[model samples]
Target: MATGRAKGRGRGRARGRDETQDERADRMWSELIQEVRVAQTGVQILFGFLLTVVFTARYPQLSQTDRTIYIVTVVLGASATGALIGPVSFHRLVSGRRIKPQAVTWASRLTLAGLLLLLATMTSALLLILRVATHGDYTPWVVVGVVAWYLLCWFVLPLWVRLRHTTID
Candidate 1:
């Protein structure tokens, strides 16, 4: 005997409370997937470019230390790519096990690890490029400056805003 608008309001009220853990996990998983999609594309592209660098003619001219750095950077890039892509594979393998909460938590960890690895890969790549392009003693300083800038932009600013605006419950 309920009207349509009353029934709609009832449904909305049902959804307004704090979500259960399972519901929260499902929502988190969807958000994580979307974030991973964005990161995976960029990491894959960067890794692909890193793989191609060794085959270029200019590679042989690099100093032994530079070669070593390049190798480490490529390995880091590969590792980052794998970590970033892991959540999709993980979700596919365990989609129906009713373990969405655990899956989401693990995927979040993997994504964080991937981001750290990506940061390292980018720093090393920048160092290599700067060294190759300008062979100057100032390269290390410049690299440090840029790394600090990246840290400030990526981590510090976000944390500062969160701390400034968010209230502790």
Candidate 2:
């Protein structure tokens, strides 16, 4: 009878792990914090560099179109920074609320949003830089190729692995 109750509780839970929901949430939260730390550092640095670009001697020499791209890139970087940092703030406000599982879910969503924003920010920054460095027809082509690489490495490969290796049990 005790074995039956244990089996019942384990149903619909992750396979190959004998952890309670709260234990799983704690593990996930730790992993998420590590991941967020890496992304946050990168976006913060990128955003800082973007902030300084306007003060550079080359700023006034930029074409109107290039300036527009720069503005867009800066805004994207700022947004990505915000999104990446949001999970920490969210966790702080909701800590000790007996909602670790919910908090983890929300944090995961924010991290994903942050990653997407970072991708957009990087794409715009690359495009603007290439345009400024070389006024040639190959600029867009180069940007497209780099963006494709990012998409493959950041999104496609991980998703493919998940789909190919994940089991239904």
Candidate 3:
């Protein structure tokens, strides 16, 4: 008769019947996929919209500086869309390779990069739009203020709350 503790069989050093590593990995993967799905849709739409802007009549009317900004924004958006969609490609290539942990790590990094790129794209887009719409001296200041607000809301607050509430064990 084999005991539950047969070497490498039963849960070991686990708090309250710890889940198998595979199970934990599977759960994390599913959560990551869900998050990626949401981000992918948003970036795809934004990138599509950006692609069409160049064909618009107003595009040629933009000042040289605004045109440069528009170009930067479009490139940033394209990069972001690629990064956000990278996980799917990664998963497809590595499926059944017993490398879920590594795949998850890489995917998470890509997602973060995508987010940062998206931030840059949005900021540049806003700056260009505001410059065209307002034509005032304060456009740059307004763009900076809005960018700062986005940084605070998207990154700072979440990090602060996480630091305040989470405990390292």
Evaluate model 1: give its TM-score. Answer: 0.85
The pairs that clash in candidate 1 are none
Candidate RMSDs in Å, in order, are 5.0, 3.9, 5.5
In model 2, the worst 10-residue window by lDDT is 2-11
Give per-residue lDDT, candidate 3, residue 58. Answer: 93
Query: C-alpha displacement of 93 in model 2, angstroms?
Result: 0.4
Residue 100 in candidate 2, Cα distance off native in Å: 1.0
Candidate 3 per-residue lDDT, tens place, 1-169, comes to: 7544453445543223245777777777899989889888988898898889899999999999989998999999999999999988999999899998888889889998998998898899888889889999998899899989989987999999999976554
CA displacement after TM-score superposition, residue 38 of candidate 3 (Å): 1.8
Instruction: Indicate the TM-score of model 3.
Output: 0.86
List the candidates' TM-scores in order: 0.85, 0.91, 0.86
Better of 2 and 3 by lDDT: 2
- Worst ten-residue run, lDDT, model 3? 8-17
Top-lDDT candidate index = 2
